[model samples]
Target: MSSPPEIGTAAAVQVQEVEHVYGTGADAVTALGPISLDVPRGSFLVIVGASGCGKSTLLRLIAGFEQPTSGAVRTAGERPLPGAGAGVVFQQPRLLPWKSVGGNVELALRYAGVPREERARRVPELLERVGLHNVAHRRIWQLSGGQQQRVAIARALAGDDPLLLLDEPFAALDALTRERLQEDLRLVSERTGRTSVFVTHSVEEAVFLGSRVVVLTKRPGRIALDLDIPLPRTGLEPDELRALPEYGALRAVLSHAVRDAAG
Candidate 1:
């Protein structure tokens, strides 16, 4: 199935002076924002920050899991509602251990209102896009951590949702697995050409995945830096991309900004 089209005149996501406070009175903690951003269609936008910098908080607003205390957040020119028109993947691959991998994705398709006949065609195709093959009938727990996460990603893409919200989905994997997943995800994003908002703490990961990167400061999590990554998004190997002088330079700039923002 084709991905959804961008809606209206606004970008895929629009955040205008959004501020989120976690409590009330003197004890209230402001977790994020009083910030704004615009994500164009088909953009791979990565948000990076130190721990406590509210990277995930902003992602939640985009995902409609939480609303801002002040201002507004919009997906496709409307107020975002959880599970509506967005697919989310988290730090853990939150799959049902009892279900086969294909079952999990098929369920997501059902919820997305896809007809049963279509889901039968889409399940394996989605898995293959994420570099998984022939394991659709396997139990979720029987797979490695990386494979489980791939299933999570396949489920996210089930509905052909125009926006993909990922909050550090690769953070918990081993180094090698993480890199492989990154490669696979990069390819998936390229293939789908859907808007993606990914939150991560790793500067390298941010540079590697994003066509654009937003770095957040600590505490109230203001935008510290918003950069457009100029590296080629495709047609090159992971090592070849990383070896470019521009790639290292972008990493250095973001690394220093992250430290400064954390401080």
Candidate 2:
């Protein structure tokens, strides 16, 4: 298997002092601001913070789902374009219940102007990559929460985009299922070599999966701490990696940063 790329190596995405606010005047709420970070090409970058810290809001800006109220956001060295090389997996599966699992993935390709024949071929492959091949013919309702999220991930990977943005995609799963899916996601990202920015509340999950983890402050968020996870990128299972001393220390540091920011 090919090695995952180095963190902060190629600059896949950059956000500079961006700010986002909703509503106007007295009713206004600031979701994120003065936030800046770079996600390197083929790296796994995770953002963690307390609720209302703008983790998801910052992700939306990078995914081009929303524009910043101030400053700048760029993807692949250019201004972010909605759904451009930005594949998103939301907390919910958000799949069309009427479509089969493979059909759901195919729909994403179809929307991206992929030909029908190509969609048929690519959908099953993407599903298999996420370990969802057996469920390709299953309906969305037939799968468990974790399986549904896998299908959602398959749909996101269907476009073969350079960047994948996930917002707490496994936050709803049972503990065991979430752990299993995390391993699977790590494998998928490794195999695909796609740069990913994941938003999560779990410091352990962030440390386990990210090449670098960035902790954000409370509302009107800014980077509080950015840490490099120095575990070997190869030949280590997810469980084994968690048991490493470096992993525990990194998690502790992140936990402190998150708690301090929240306080």
Candidate 3:
């Protein structure tokens, strides 16, 4: 796998003094920064905060879903273009009902301009990367919720974009399923060596996945805590790693930070 840029190199993403607001005049509500952050290439950066703290809002700005009301968001030092430089996955699977499992991914590959002949080899390859094997023929509704979400992930990977932005993509799953997917995601990012930014409310989730984690304060959000996680990124099972005292310490710190930020 390709390694991340050297520590002091240009960041893969740069959020410079950005702020976002909704509405106008007296009704306008500020949603995000006046906050700035840098995400280095091939590192997994996770953003965590209480609900309504602009977690999703920040992720959207990075994805170029909406331009910030102030400041700038740049991916690889260029203004992000929605659906171009990044691949995004939302909380819901949002798969097309009429499409088969493989079809959904093939459609994404098509949009990504992968040739028809190449799609045959790429579809299953992407699915297998997400741990979905041999279910390409299944209908969307036929698979369990977890399986559907896996398809969503595979489709997102089909874009083969440089950055991956996920907004609580596993937030709705059962504990077991969510944990499983988290491990899968960690492995996939390692294998692909992609730069990723994930947003979530779960402290454990943030600490588990992030190479670096940032916490946001409530309303008109700003950075409260920005910390790098020192846990081993590879080796050991997820459960084994989470049980370490160091993991518990980071989780506790973020949990408290989130509560205070919600004030």
Candidate 4:
């Protein structure tokens, strides 16, 4: 793979020799072993591995929802601070049942200390960005599964943070809806120039969305392969990228890595 991006430069996030373990002593389990990686500013990085491979654990560490058992995790030149430099989207929408779609997003802004008056303006704009402005006043229950996930994404972006961490956000959707959202996510990431780290078990999704794809080994996850994706980044449809010969080659390589890790 091309040299990994330099850490703490313009890169939006950094993970250096990071490890995470659960339980203690005889019962200890290392969910993720030491691994180092740097994600270039405004680039999309996808981590793909089987279940129990520490994919979600890594995202959690970067989001500061969990502290590392050892080593360091940093974003923008400092150790990650909870709710500081990152925005996270999980597999489920996680919207408050009682809140309107706009209200859900507005809540995230409020927690980020956005002025009340500004939240009124920002909420609509964010919904529009995610193609859900028409449902801005709708209750969370009114939206389809896909639409709810879009709202979740809007809420995550409401913070306008530099780093975005997504853990299988589209895994539960039907294939068609998942593909559509993947395209939307690619466009949004490109438009906003935000650095993103997405974790998923889908090789196709990883190859399609990432500037670089990092595959990890099974339990006690380790970086098994870091592969650069060479699909053209400009004026190309997501489908077109998938059709490219390079895309298929990369997919095959990642497929093998996944099998090896699982075996």
TM agreement with the true structure for every prediction:
0.96, 0.93, 0.95, 0.94
Q: What is the lDDT of every predicted structure here?
A: 0.92, 0.87, 0.90, 0.89
Q: Which residue window of length 10 is worst by lDDT in model 1?
A: 1-10
Candidate 1 residue lDDT tens string, 154-206: 99999899999999999999999999999999989998989999999999999
Q: CA lDDT of 30 in candidate 3? A: 95
Clash number for every model? 1, 0, 0, 0
Per-residue lDDT of 170-208 in model 4, one digit per residue for the tens?
999999999999998998998999999999999999999
Question: Candidate 2, TM-score vs. the true structure?
Answer: 0.93
- Candidate number of the best lDDT: 1
Expressed as tens digits, the lDDT of each residue in 205-227 for candidate 3 is 99999999999999989999999
C-alpha lDDT of residue 26 in model 2 = 100
Ranking by TM-score: 1, 3, 4, 2
Pairs clashing in candidate 3? none
Candidate 2: stretches off by over 4 Å: 1-10
Candidate 2 lDDT trough over 10 residues, lowest sum: 1-10
Relative to the true structure, candidate 3 reaches a TM of 0.95
In candidate 3 the C-alpha lDDT for residue 112 amounts to 96
Top candidate when judged by TM-score against the true structure: 1
